[model samples]
Target: ALAVGVAAAALLGFAVALTVTGLDGPEARRAAAPPGPAAAGAASRPAGAPDTDPDGAGTLREGDSGPAVSELQQRLLRVPDVYRDGATDGHYDAVLRAAVARFQLWYGIRGDESGVYGDDTRRDLESRTVR
Candidate 1:
C-alpha cells in the first residue's frame, strides 16, 4: 500500500510538471497574447452573415448618443462581466467605454483604442453573439 501511494503521488507530480511546461508552448502563448494589432487579424469570420460594421467606420466613443449606442450597450450586456450595470439608454458614457474596453481586453481585440469601438471589436462581439 505504501509503494502504491508513492507511485501515484509521483505520477501526479509528473503530470503537473508536464502541464506547466506545456503552458509555455506556442499555442499557449498565442492563447494568452494581449490584445493588440497583432492579435486583431488572428480570427476570421465565417461565411453567411454579413460583416457587422457595414459602414466601415465602426467608431463608437464616449459622448455619442442614439439608437446605435443603445444597441452597442445591449450587445455588451450579453458578454458576462463586460457590462454589469445593464443600462441601455443610448448614451455612450464612461461606463459604456469601460465595458467596451473590458470586452476588448477579454477577447484580445485591439484594432481600435481601449475604450473606442471600432471594426475589430464590433466584428468580434458580433461573432460571439446572436442578432
Candidate 2:
C-alpha cells in the first residue's frame, strides 16, 4: 500500500510539472505580454525620460512606435534649448518629425527632406547624442 501511494504521488508531480511546462509555449507566452510597464506606465511618459535603445525597430517614420522612438526623443531632449517641445511618448509624431529635421539640419546632413529616422539619421543621432 505504501508503494502504491508513493507511485501515485510521483505520477501527480509529473503531471503538474508537465502542465506548468506546457503553459510556457509560444501561444501562452504571447497571451501574457501586456499589463507590464511597456503596455502600462511607460506608454504614457512625458517628453523628458532617459531611455536606451531596446530594439532597432526597423526605420522609424511619422507613425512608428517603439523603444527606439523613446530613445530618440530622449536624445533630442538632451538639447533642451533646441528641442524644447519634444516628447518621449515612444511614438513618431509631428513634434518628433520636426525635432528630427532640426537634428538633421544641425548635423548638416543634406538631401533628406522627409524627416524620417532612417539609417543615416540614426547613425548621426547615435554619434551626436550626449549620453
Candidate 3:
C-alpha cells in the first residue's frame, strides 16, 4: 500500500512538474513517453475505428469495450487527477467518464467529454500518449 501511494505521488509530482515547466521541451516528452506505436513528434492514435473525430484519436464512448478503452484509461491514470485504480479493466464505466471529463477540462476539449470518448476527446487524450 505504501509503495503504491509513493509511486503514485512520485508520478503525480512528475506530472505537475511537466505541466508547469512546459512539455515543449524534449526532456518532458522522453520523461512521459506513453505506450504506443508512434515515435517522437508523431500522432499516437491507438489505431481502431475510422477517423471520424477531428483529432482522429477515435470515437469510443461509455459501454464500449476492448483495447482502446484500456489505452484511454492508462493515459488517464498518468494525468494523476484520474486517481482511480484498476482503470485498465477495459470497461468504459462511470469512473472513466469522470476521469475523461477531467481530462477534457484540462485540455479544453468540451462538447461531450462526459465519458463519451468522442473524437475531440480522443484527439486531445491521444496527443498525450507516448508512442
Give stretches of model 3 more than 4 Å off: 1-57, 111-113
The TM-score values for the models, in the order shown, are 0.56, 0.51, 0.51
Instruction: Report lDDT per candidate.
Output: 0.81, 0.74, 0.73
Model 3, residue 86: C-alpha shift (Å): 4.3
- Top of the candidates by lDDT: 1
What TM-score would you give candidate 2 relative to the actual structure?
0.51
Poorest lDDT segment (10 consecutive residues) of candidate 2: 50-59
For candidate 2, lDDT tens digit of each residue in 16-109?
A: 7657878656755565455776767676776676543332335677888989889988887876464686778899888888888888888786
Q: Per-residue lDDT of 47-113 in model 1, one digit per residue for the tens?
A: 4644554325657889989998998999988888899976899999999989998998889986688
Superposed by TM-score, candidate 1 places the C-alpha of residue 52 at a distance from the truth, in angstroms, of 18
Question: At residue 82, what lDDT does model 3 achieve?
Answer: 59
Winning candidate number (TM-score):
1
TM-score rank order: 1, 3, 2
Residue pairs in candidate 1 whose N, alpha carbon or C atoms collide under 3 angstroms? none
Candidate 2's C-alpha runs over 4 A off are 1-57, 111-113
